[model samples]
Target: MMPLSMVASGETVRLIAVRGGRGICFRLAELGLVPGATFQVIQGSGQGPLILAFGETRLALGRGMAHKIYVESFMRGGQECQNN
Candidate 1:
């Protein structure tokens, strides 16, 4: 598993785990970031907020918050990355 922040822009990734205190986890979960959730990284850089797309909703997650969320990036046709 890798930090959500490391995912490439425009790639769809599956949420694997969320690391942090209960408050953080609760906040993320409230935003629909629970484990097994799938979302596409709308935008990402080493700086600024990371934008994630879940269906029609878009959420801007701070870099620090994003780092605490781990994910598994998947390719087209729902194939997971073997190199991870």
Candidate 2:
């Protein structure tokens, strides 16, 4: 598994776990980042920030912050859900 920050542009991944204190964990959860949730890396600013989409919301996160969020890469057509 790679940290969410490591996800490349246009790549998709699944939320596996979060490594951080309760406050940071709660912050991520409130942003719709949770176990099993899938998201795509829309863009990554060279400095550190990344833009991601989960469900219908788009969020931007810094690399230092994203490193605390662990994720696993998912291939296209790996899993199907009623929603896209």
Candidate 3:
């Protein structure tokens, strides 16, 4: 797993876990960020807040906070998941 801050732009990733305190977790969850949710990176390069698209909503997450979010490729295996 990798931090959300490291995910390449245009990649769709699934949230795995949060490695922060309760307060932080709650705050992020309130913004629609939680385990199992999927998100696409708009901008991320291990610097600054990450600009991510969570469905129709756009979220800007600070680098520190972004680092707390662990994710994996949303696609199963090495292939991209297809839309039905």
Candidate 4:
């Protein structure tokens, strides 16, 4: 899996796992970024900030924070694949 920050705008991805401590993990979870949740990359500042959408909720995540959130890109015709 790759970091959420690496996903391009308009890309859809599935949250796989969080690879950080409790504080970071808990914070992301509270923001609706949980395992198995599908998300889309709405906007990215390219300098760290990114807008992520899951269901109807949107979240702004920094590069450092997003890097800890492991995600796999979703393809329309088949199973999801881990992003590099």
Please list all clashing residue pairs in model 4, or write none if there are none.
none
TM-score of 3: 0.85
Q: Find the candidate with the highest lDDT and give its number.
A: 3
Q: Give the TM-score of each candidate.
A: 0.85, 0.81, 0.85, 0.81
Over 4 Å off, model 1: 76-84
Residue-wise C-alpha lDDT for candidate 3, range 9-81, written one tens digit per residue: 8999988788889898889889888777898999988677889999999988888988888888898623332
Candidate 3 residues lying further than 4 Å off, grouped into runs, are: 77-84
The numbered model that scores best in TM-score is 3
Candidate 2 per-residue lDDT, tens place, 2-80, comes to 7777777988888777888888778987877877788888995366689998778899888898887877777743443
Residue range 1-84, candidate 1, lDDT tens digits: 788888889889888778889998889889887777889999975788999999799999999988988888655334332321
Going through the candidates in the order shown, the clash numbers are 0, 0, 0, 0
Residue 58 in candidate 3, Cα distance off native in Å: 0.3
Error of 1 at 72 (Å): 0.3
Query: Best to worst by lDDT, what's the order?
Result: 3, 1, 4, 2
lDDT of each: 0.81, 0.77, 0.82, 0.77
Return the clash pairs for model 1, or none.
none
